[model samples]
Target: MLTPKQARFVEEYLIDMNATRAAIRAGYSEKTANQQGPRLLEHAEIAAAIDAAKGARSERARIDALWVLQRLVFEAEADLADLFGDNGELLPVEAWPLIWRQGLVQGVEVLELFEGYGADRVHIGRLRKIKLDSRVKRIELIGKHIGVNAFRENVHHTGLDALGDRLERALKRNH
Candidate 1:
């Protein structure tokens, strides 16, 4: 049976995959979390708990890695030109879908514009635009999960190859 602290550590570890941070979050001493995290992961009970939790989460969500990749790839954005009105002003907040509103609206700023009157001022609106999250990065992450990479061809040698090369050089120098 896992202790309460160990159970908490396993839960936290699943959240971020950082053992030290998980230990700290699980109420371990900050000074010792760095060491405790790795040690807890090594415990068989904790490991099993984490694996079981991950399986349960996957079953509940009914989403696999492929589904996540597909969703990221298919995040269709609305036309940027349509976001503005005929007067070149941003449309009302309710005009776009929630996803569009979240991704396109970087920020809202209200500017006080003074007219000819001394105490009267009109509030002007400014909407900052931010680029949507890059599809390239999302694709890269998907490729990583799928064990595919365009740059893998560039890496020619395995770890053993480098060690062999070093040994050959040492032997040649000795001879």
Candidate 2:
């Protein structure tokens, strides 16, 4: 069984994977958190708890690198114009698809004016904006995932040829 402090530490670590910060959030002394955090991770019980928490979080969110890549590369695109009405009113949230709707809005200010008056109430509400992810960037990331050197526009060679070159260099240095 893990101690209360250790359990808290595991919970905090999963937030952003910063050991020192987790220790501090788990009620450890700030002065000692830096050291205590890593030490807690070394404990068997604490480590298992962290792994279990990570697994549970993954299962709940169903999010992985592949899911992210697919969302970035293959998901449907949304336009800001489609999300708003011509009268400067935001359309219903249901208009947006599930995935695109998450970040599909940016709130803006709409100032109303009364005739012959200084000003009316300022309305604060959601405004639609183009939030499309860059297709080029997504494609580049996919390229990197498949071992393509995006910078040089070529594939990275880490096979026998690279090893043979290193061996030749070492042989020359030994001579």
91-117: candidate 1 lDDT, tens digit per residue? 776875665665545555555454455
Best by TM-score: 1
Task: Give the TM-scores of the predictions, in the order they appear.
Answer: 0.59, 0.50
Q: After superposition, how far is residue 72 of candidate 2 from its true place, in Å?
A: 2.4
Residue 28 miss distance in model 2 (angstroms)? 1.6
In candidate 1, stretches whose alpha carbon ends up further than 4 angstroms from where it belongs are 25-30, 58-63, 76-90, 108-131, 145-148, 151-175
Cα displacement (angstroms), candidate 1, residue 107, comes to 3.9
Please report the candidate that would top lDDT against the real structure. 1
Clashing pairs in 2: none
Lowest lDDT 10-mer window, candidate 2?
Answer: 104-113
Candidate 2 — what's its lDDT? 0.73
Collision count for each candidate, in order: 0, 0
Measured with C-alpha atoms, the lDDT of residue 95 in candidate 2 is 64
